[model samples]
Target: MPQGISTLAADTPTLSAANTGFMLICSALVMIMTPGLAFFYGGMVRVKSTLNMLMMSFISLGIVTILWVVYGFSLAFGTDKGSIIGWSSDYVGLSGIGITQLWDGYTIPVYVFAVFQLMFAIITPALISGALADRVKFTAWALFIALWVTVVYFPVAHWVWGAGGWLFELGVIDFAGGTAVHINAGAAALGVILVIGKRIGFKKDPMRPHSLPLVMLGAGLLWFGWFGFNAGSWLGNDDGVGAVMFVNTQVATAAAMLAWLAYEKIRHGAFTTLGAASGAVAGLVAITPSGGAVSPLGAIAVGAIAGVLCAMAVGLKFRFGYDDSLDVVGVHLVGGVVGSLLVGFFATGGVQSDVKGLLYGGGLDQLGKQAIGVGAVLAYSLVVSALLAFVLDKTIGMRVEEDVEVSGIDQDEHAETAYDFSGAGGGAGSRKAAPAPGDSVAPAAKTKKVDA
Candidate 1:
């Protein structure tokens, strides 16, 4: 071979491995967000459903992992038809993907790429279910996720990420799923909340969280894992990866946290734990799409704006009478929009095979493209998600029996409790029934209620 070709071949393998390694780590980081979501939502809900909320997030770890290996990947990254769904020729467990490759400029194994992307796929829908927490049957949720992934997530993923995807062809830059994951999940959450309705005694009850510590722990894990999320988007361990994403992640989250607290202090008269957790997540969601494209300063602005906007948008649920049980729509949907649109203005020069945004003096031309892209994704996700929910409701039914919901899903659906106070002999957050106010010796069976 010529010296030039020989050198190119020698260099390619090293780059490929690095890309694969980066993506694998990034996938794991994204996976960690599921638990983060569990805690973030867990802390906002009443104590009765805390474990149930955690379980909901945990279950995705199992369900999505399996589906991705089966046909989820093929349905997403395979050949496209009608710019909607993917072909099945690459089906039966990532058959053709690992043999050849779709993405260029990186040498990672295709399976590595699939699994990494798979983690993002797994967690996105799971993030939305927080809005339906504490009420829906576990069985119903499982079925919903299975069906939703096939119908909603896979097609949207294809439209954004697949080879012939319309968005890809249009030169829209998702970088890391602002459109595909966060915005899509947020919109879907809105639809599910509309279908499922609000939690019982939503505003009337105090509905305080059972554990603040768990909320903090979840946030910590999310922050730690985000390094992988932002850096890994580079698709390789190349030289610019560290400086570009690391600062973007750090500053954006910090700006978001401060903005959230500031908003809380102004609106509610104090800084709240729930606000802190929610703000961090909002910052993370906002930065997700813009991280690779924007400068650190731009990220801070994006994070701060997302944090405050989401904090304010939470009030919309109450005003509109939508439950959105845990504000998935408020944070992710709103935050994703903030990031996506801002990238149009703030995206810097020199970070892609091609394309530049407003900051590179490319003007609003890029922003206009971004706006169109966002509209397309939003419209498609909303319509498809509503249809999927409609079908599931008519078929297996969307909710649990009213009795089961009143009783609790942990015992009813899973046949397991998140905590066993009696079994464990008094752990901090154990489940136990409290005596009725009028009872001397269990006077009225119905009067006694369990501690949340």
Candidate 2:
């Protein structure tokens, strides 16, 4: 054998068992985020719509997983045909791919890379479900997810991450998915809400969260899983950069939660649990894109800003009469923009990528690039999502009937309820009629009707 050939062969990148294990574990962590999102969204909606909220996120896990293996991965990460999208059928159903083939510049197998990306594809659409919580039809939502991912997500992923992708080539920084995931979903949520219109009673009804505890639990899961969502994007087990991202994620989230509580106390006269949970999510979204590029202090700034901004942005629904069911647009969209743009200012160049922000003396070049990327995604997602919602609304009906929505979406859409209260009355399933206002003899048997 020629010495040059032997030398090249010897230097070829090989799989690292540690990195592979790390990535696989990260994949599982990211996978759990969708269910965490389900619980997060499920708790924010009324009880009547809780199961429906959960189903919306859960269905994405099933649907996107199948689509990803079939063609989604190819379209998103296949050989890039142009800056717009990827084109190559070779990877469809992961055909002709070898188990030993390593991802470019990485130690993990290509299959591991594919599945990790698949988790991202799953959560993007699910994030939008929080916006359309109560009124959407199950069949229509399923169809919408199928079409939206095909048209919007796959192409956008290509534009951001595919080889020779426009944004990637232009040096726009999105460490995780600030633009392709959160901003895209947030803008899409707004567009769909515009088409679907407000819930039956927008500002008139209380429409408070059905279960704050559930929301908190879901938030905790999200925070836990987000370590993978952000740091795992590194696609390796490098202790230096990955550990930096991990610590940044934690500090940013904590800062945002505290900022949110402070804001809540001042604005609403109380520090609410919902504020804490929402604040943490806001911080998570903010740090996802910038964590790799910024220092721990930078992460705190990003988180604090995102927390305050998202808190205020959530009220936009009420002011503008749009009725984002669970503040998806406010938190994800706004926080995403905050994070992505802040990267231009906080990027320290040597830590992650070679880009630096204005504060770091990199000038407005990176910031402008971030803006363009954000605008392009925001416009594309909004227009495309609106058009899709309109077409679905016109043809097969995107929302449930007024009567069904008024009664309950869970019972009508899924034929089941989240909580069964039928067994609450008496022993052996005996019924108990409602007592007159003051007629309760025993406090233990008395039931208080809480407003939904």
Provide the lowest-lDDT 10-residue window in model 2: 1-10
Model 1: lDDT equals 0.77
lDDT, candidate 1, 246-285, per-residue tens: 7888889989989999999998899987788879988988
The most accurate candidate by TM-score is 2
Top lDDT hit: 2
User: Would you list the C-alpha lDDT of every candidate in the order shown?
Assistant: 0.77, 0.90
Candidate 1: misplaced stretches above 4 Å? Answer: 1-15, 96-103, 423-452
* Residue 386 lDDT (model 1): 75
State in Å the error of residue 32, model 1. Answer: 2.3
TM-score of candidate 1 relative to the true fold: 0.87
- Model 2's alpha-carbon lDDT is 0.90
Error of 1 at 319 (Å): 0.4
